[model samples]
Target: MTKHRVRTVERYTRRTRWYHAAVYITVLALLGTGWWLLTGREGEPSPAARLTGAADVTLHTYAGWVLTGLTAVAITLGARAARTFVVESVRVDKGDLRWFIRWPVAVVTGRFSHHRGHFDPGQRVANLVLVTLLAALVASGVGLTMVVGGPGFVWLQRVHRWATYLITPVLAGHILIAAGLLPGYRGVARAMHLGGRLRVDTARRVWPGWLDRRLAEDDKQPARAEGDSPD
Candidate 1:
């Protein structure tokens, strides 16, 4: 009998995985408390607020603070990675339009168009939109915290509310895709969780350009090492 072997690729570093976990947890907490408070439930404590012995407003405020701290830490400690993320998210490839056109069908069929980038066209657009919305939320939240009552406070509140409204659906779609609920995205959740490793074939199908570059770099290692070795 022959044994079957499967190859895997490292999709995220430990730090990146940890950072992602922190951000999502904080964001979810903020959303839950924010929504509850928004819907005339500020007088009633949420489960988390009751558990923590804090008001919903307090919990939401602290969650925002945690998110802010996390962002600062990521920026300070992972500057290069942050820059790379922004650069990759903003880049456009020649095939991106075609990829976007095919994406709707591909979601159900599990067939995607080929493009050259770290992120697919859909992912790049998602990244940009998500980041912008999150930034707006953060900035408006900070303004709300600082201002007691004025036109500025009202404006900030409007921005914060609108950002939340926009981000909720966007985040929902992101979660659906990232969770591998879509046929085309099967196995993609492993890239950020389950030890941040992905099956090589899955990575090839979803991120062919990234996989190709990674493999090319890997192929150069042996030759480079041999050249550096002393006789």
Candidate 2:
């Protein structure tokens, strides 16, 4: 295998990374619990069932609090940055037009070659949708949880149920796409664990101003006068 040396733009800061880690772990918790509940394992009085049942609900609630708190903090701390991420991921740019059109056909015809650097148009669109949908699901979920002691909390539960159900297919697609693009599940795992570096080409394409400026600065150095040059 050939290795390419490229500069990685810093896309995630420490705070951002921590927030994302919590959100992902919580999401996994929710999904695992929901799966068990749906499979009837959560209802049964078996050790695994009872354990997962209470654990999942407690986790699901606390996870909501953590995610919501982080989201609020993010918006407060970096409104412009958060807005930019949303817009960039959702906007279908010119480059994406061709990639989106060709990708499905290529996959169908067994010609789906993985490209390095940046999300293609289709992936961007899907990411945008997934983020938005999941955000809504989380919001609805937390809102529902709050009304537990009130009348019509059943309505809230129903909403949460539907939102939870909607994630199944989306989760599948998200997994499949990651699996296809990464070397293996481990590759995807590493990417998340490390807040994956953006490919140079992709980063340049997406944020030319930021990437190019840094690259140019790195490459350029002022020459010293002969008298002043280090001996």
Candidate 3:
């Protein structure tokens, strides 16, 4: 079985890839450390409690800062691309709706629909929610620094907690997809490469509209150059 038939394309830049990996690591670390902090009730210190230690708050705080910093860096690195993605994500048509309808089946059967958008309809919706929730999470986290022991602090804590709870599952799904654990999305995980490439076929199927537009743009460049040449 020769797998060399798949052509490769640059789907993500190295810096973008790093941003993604850092975001994943930072969020998971924050979640793990923050979980016990959020859920544990008063009790005598157990081994697990001892494991968490007093610095847990500090760890979570710094992790939150790292998350914010990375988010900033990502935007700085790819402001144009990021803006394009956000703008394109607002578009939805019958194709996207069909993709969403078959999404669950794809998850179970490993046979994905040929989605033709910057993001599938489900992904666009999820992306919007996550962006909104993450912004709330960061805002509340920063606000916690400002109000330590007042009603404001209580409200901010709830905001932070609720946002964390909401994004946890989305984050889990993201991790699963990146790790190629999802059924139809197996090889699709390679798109998050740190200066790595993507299989052309996977790119075409998963991001057909994007791939097509990009290729069309590439084609135009050569023609434009020729047209500009002096005889």
lDDT of 2 by residue, 8-61 (tens): 444445566666677667676667766666566644444434665655556556
| Local accuracy of candidate 1 as per-residue lDDT tens digits, 1-231 | 855655677777888999999999999999999999889999988999889999999999999999989879868988899999999999988989989999999988878999888999999999999899999999999889899999999999999999999999999999999999999999999899976777777888889999898878777432122112222
Quality of model 3 by C-alpha lDDT? 0.72
The candidate, 1 or 2, that scores higher on TM-score is 1
- By TM-score, the best candidate is 1
User: What are the per-residue Cα lDDT tens digits for candidate 3 across 149-217?
Assistant: 988889999999999899889988767776768767767777786235666666676677767766676
TM-score of candidate 3 against the unseen true structure: 0.80
Q: Name the regions of candidate 2 deviating beyond 4 angstroms.
A: 1-11, 45-54, 105-119, 148-152, 179-195, 198-231
Model 1, residue 173: what's the lDDT? 99
The weakest ten consecutive residues by lDDT in model 3 span: 222-231
Q: For all the candidates, what are their Cα RMSDs to the real structure?
A: 5.0, 7.7, 6.7
Model 1 earns a TM-score of: 0.93
Q: For model 1, what is the error of residue 11's alpha carbon versus the real structure, in angstroms, after optimal superposition?
A: 1.2
For all candidates in order, the CA lDDT equals 0.88, 0.57, 0.72
Candidate with more favorable, higher TM-score: 1 or 3: 1
